[model samples]
Target: MTNSPAGHTPNVVLITGTSSGIGLHAAIAAAQAGHTVVATMRNLEGTRALLDAADAAGVTLDIRRLDVTEAQSVTEVVAGIVGRYGRLDAVVNNAGSGHLGTIENETIDQVRAVMEVNFFGVVGVTRAALPHLRTSHGRLITVTSVGGVIGQPFNEAYCAAKFAVEGFMESLAPVVRSAGVSVTVVEPGAVATSFVANVGFDPTAPAAVGDPYAAGLAAYLARAGSSFASAQTAESAGSVVAALLDGDVPPFRVQTSDAARQFVGVKLADLDGSAVQRLTSGWIA
Candidate 1:
């Protein structure tokens, strides 16, 4: 969707991962757009940035605690919101993690940890809120990544989960729309955010004793660092996400920037997108 705002009624919006980055800005932007925002995070201990941003934006948000990976927490949060507001209008599944490891190096449990947060976390939240969304004719928006479209090295588990999210939402969109709930996924490319900081990957570190992938890891990290150095800001991407909430009909898919669009354009077509794929090939070369 374009960064154009549409006329919209105030909605009760539930957003996950509001402690920082896209989620923090998104919660604030949605509130600034006049939505009744419930900004939630896994732990309430880190509300500093979110609170500060809300204050700076001059918008009040209902702060709550929600862990998307926990079934009970997801269910209870959605139930509580409906009970408090008398209706539920929208949910933004923005809680996610960054993992930087290939399968052989990362244990099965580690991969499962990634899926639990990125994939099942989304499923849990969406499932819990679907009933209310159906009743309210509301929206379901997820913050997926460009990695969801174009798989990246060292992001196997992360990309797989995102790919599953994209596939699940794509398949559910039409069926859910028939029930009055709209589903949309916002895809972003490299963004200037704490996401990378949280990945725990140190290219400068000595590789584990005789790690076979050390050289490839270093090359990929160098290119990735450059991509992020020129990355779009979290606030810009957040605003694009916020704009979608007001439209009468949200696009089935939205890439938050030109880079994101060009990246995802690879899977959507066989033209210039192929050139983009070849560019990543050099990252591990």
Candidate 2:
């Protein structure tokens, strides 16, 4: 097990998707806070960016290759961490892909693809690490989105997957609490990142010829552009995950920014689903 300068045992944090964005930032933040971080991504070649950032910040991470979509990869990485550290204290499920476009525009394959990464990917990782987590009485932090709480227009598939994640974690939280494991879902609103681009959506592109949903899509794009223009930084979002990992008792649900809180608050405050429908309808209208 790793030890801090003061000789206290340090937490061993496993963070997925450390190639960039929130994952990379969270790995650095955790390492800087004295936790031993095993930063994993689909491709080890992508570790250069994370390594450069960690070097600049004077933090070190044990980098590994892990593809959450692959069950073998998940099992191997988790086993390796436990073998080396003797315990796994926390897991940050940040390896996710976004899907844009309406339900009509997205094919069944595309929908399944998003679910594979955003929802089932979390399941794969959590299932693999839960044994070790239960042994250590550790934490499980998954980076969901505000869309998970209130589905946004043109984000049908992505939101559906996130909603599944939220429900799954919520249901598992109590069950795992008995085993001394905590489950927390970290929700973040729009952040300045390449997420949209990585999702293969071009907000500035001209609408597809003769598409019925073109107008609504354009409107959603405009609103997303404005939201991202004033979006929070990736580092800000990562800090939320880091904080939850370091906390003795983390809340079941947390929003990274106040804007995220406000966005998700609307849904939590509404007993009926009408308020969210009305708000979402306004975007298309």
Candidate 2 minimal-lDDT segment of 10 residues: 1-10
Per-residue accuracy of model 1 over 171-258 as CA lDDT, tens digit each: 9999998987888999999999999999867766788888898888888988888999999999999998888788566888999999
**Per-model CA lDDT versus the true structure:** 0.88, 0.89
RMSD values for the candidates in order, in angstroms, are 3.0, 2.5
Q: What is the lDDT of candidate 1?
A: 0.88
CA shift of 122, model 1, Å: 0.2
Q: Write the per-residue lDDT of candidate 2 for residues 9-100, one digit (tens) a residue.
A: 68889999999999989999999888999999998988888989999999889999999999999999999999999889889999999888
Candidate 1 Cα errors over 4 Å, as ranges = 1-9, 271-277
